[model samples]
Target: MDGHPLRLALDLLKGTLALTVHKIRYGLASRLWHGTNLVTEQMSRHTQQVRLLRAGEVLGSLDVSTVRDEIGSRRGTVSFNGCLHQLFSGQPLTRQEKALVLAQLVASFSLTTSYDFADSPLLDGDDRLLMREVLYGAGFAAREMRTFIYQSRQDGQDTTADIESKSTREQTRSATRKLEVVDVSLDEFIRFHDANLAQKHNYRRWDIDAAFVADALALGKARILAARGRSADGLTPQGIQAAMIYTWDDISLKLYRISYDTAKTANPHANKVLIARGMQMAHDLGLLLDTDCAPPGAAILYERFGFPERVRTHYVRATLLSKFAAFIRRDFPSLDRRLRPWVIRAVTRVNRSAA
Candidate 1:
């Protein structure tokens, strides 16, 4: 019976319902009842019993004041990955040393950003639980932590740490590539976006606020990336031939913006190079790669690159409904209006959020 399709469907439904209920309960307990302290305390005890370093010890290595200074002085000039590269100097670190550095970086950033380091998505589920306690017990907020972690992730520091071996290999090949994609400074990124991608995207602003972009880039340094292709003569650099913007959305590296200058550049691989770089970054970070939107033609390219496509049935349905909503509302007034309203709301939210 367990192998039967109907049985499987029932099991799936049951699991979804149970998860929904658990989330609701957790939300209420954590927010309304302030039950975070209990969980925090339990995690704290677990860490202590396991003989893990105390919160103070972990945080001592990367002091808060030092982080503050770095944030102030190096906001847009350096990336977390760049900093790690300088610190480790391409040397391999043991698992323990890596973890310690990750924890310290998270703690330092959390302190400066006024966010809970423990709740950072950079941590795996178990690590997040453990660090939640550590950070909370160390006087970081258990509740009301905000969006600083997202920015920290864009810096690509911790993720870079995880992929040091891969980066080292890529570094060795750097001398051979004549036209390569590279990290651009924020000003360069903004100018390229304004000139190239913004036009391609119809001057549509990415959902990211300009101020947020500034702040995130200042913090993460990996948020904006660009590439230069060959000039018309195919021998020299053609400035800003391709560009892209991406950020860590949970465990996925979501590519939100991309453009290539196919007309001016002699290099046909401009787009591919930019995309491949993003794929490599995703692989290094141990994250899946996704994009916000891809046109119908781009779908074929994504498929060729091994990205499985799910036809967004909701989009199809909403589009159909949008065309027929007034007609339906006028012709069938007595029919249930609830679904129309729900669909409209969902569609509105999606459109507003789209780049």
Candidate 2:
């Protein structure tokens, strides 16, 4: 009885109606409070376009024709531009259609790009395999493989005692004597982020502009944690030793973007405490904890904190020769078989040099 199609349809209908009502209520509230600004306008348009695209995708009607038509009609609009990549992300695409989308993505964002699809968590193995095949067929090669590790809410709970070891508790108390972790305002987060920009990897930069942070906060998607050293007077703190910026996943409520200050610090355990605090926050929120796109040696630290690796995905780039080889393979199949080995060797050399 619970598995009836009518029951499922009713649930879907209710969800759709609830979402529509929520959007209307939020729009009215925003108009009352923010009073309409350029940012608000852009956000509104973006939201509407995304909603349309999502609706199309969910109905299984978002074909290449629809994508091209929308792109043509909404060309240069903030809405379309904001979600152009997303338009194809959730749709089941043919190889040729995927190639076209990949071409557009390369043109808009360069040969190297990494972003979660619109329905990442919902994608099964077949979907992921298709996406991988599409990328491979589009001449992309792996750059770095990042694994996402998650701890279930139930598993994450009851770990307080495990985390607060006698040694760690003593150390934490001692560390807190000289240092404190505090919640930072958006403005403070921005300032700290900007100040530490030079510390981040040049290739793997996370865009942290004020508007983005503000929007994230408004949508309840982000949190900022800062560690400040205590003053001699035991009242005021000194400077920031570390800060962590974590964002929430809407569907899974999983935590992401678990970044911390990389600047040299006197206390080696500062980052550990910050990570522990992040886990606690996740537990408090009754959500899984997830960290994505970690740098080298980061997995070791995360493992130390009880987060085992779950999914490994790679950041890939398409080289000119690889694209040329792919083009040859597609256009001249006979030539491709004869030159495949040479092309592989050439690509390998180029990748090594680039690395």
Candidate of highest TM-score: 2
The per-prediction tally of clashing pairs is 1, 0
Summarize candidate 1's per-residue lDDT along 1-355 as a digit string, tens digits: 1244456445434533433443444333433342111112111110110111233232112211111111121111112111111222123655444444333333223111222111222334544455444333333333322111111233443332222245432432341164666677656766766665444545443322343345445445237777774356876755777778776532456565676666643455566556666766776676656544467666555545545543211100011232244344555666637555665566556645752
Q: Which candidate comes out best when scored by lDDT?
A: 2
User: lDDT of model 2 at residue 123?
Assistant: 39
Candidate 2 stretches greater than 4 Å from native: 1-124, 134-144, 152-159, 162-178, 193-211, 231-234, 252-265, 314-355
Displacement of residue 347 (Cα, Å) in model 1 is: 26
TM-scores, one per candidate? 0.38, 0.50
Task: Name the 10 consecutive residues with the lowest summed lDDT in model 2.
Answer: 63-72
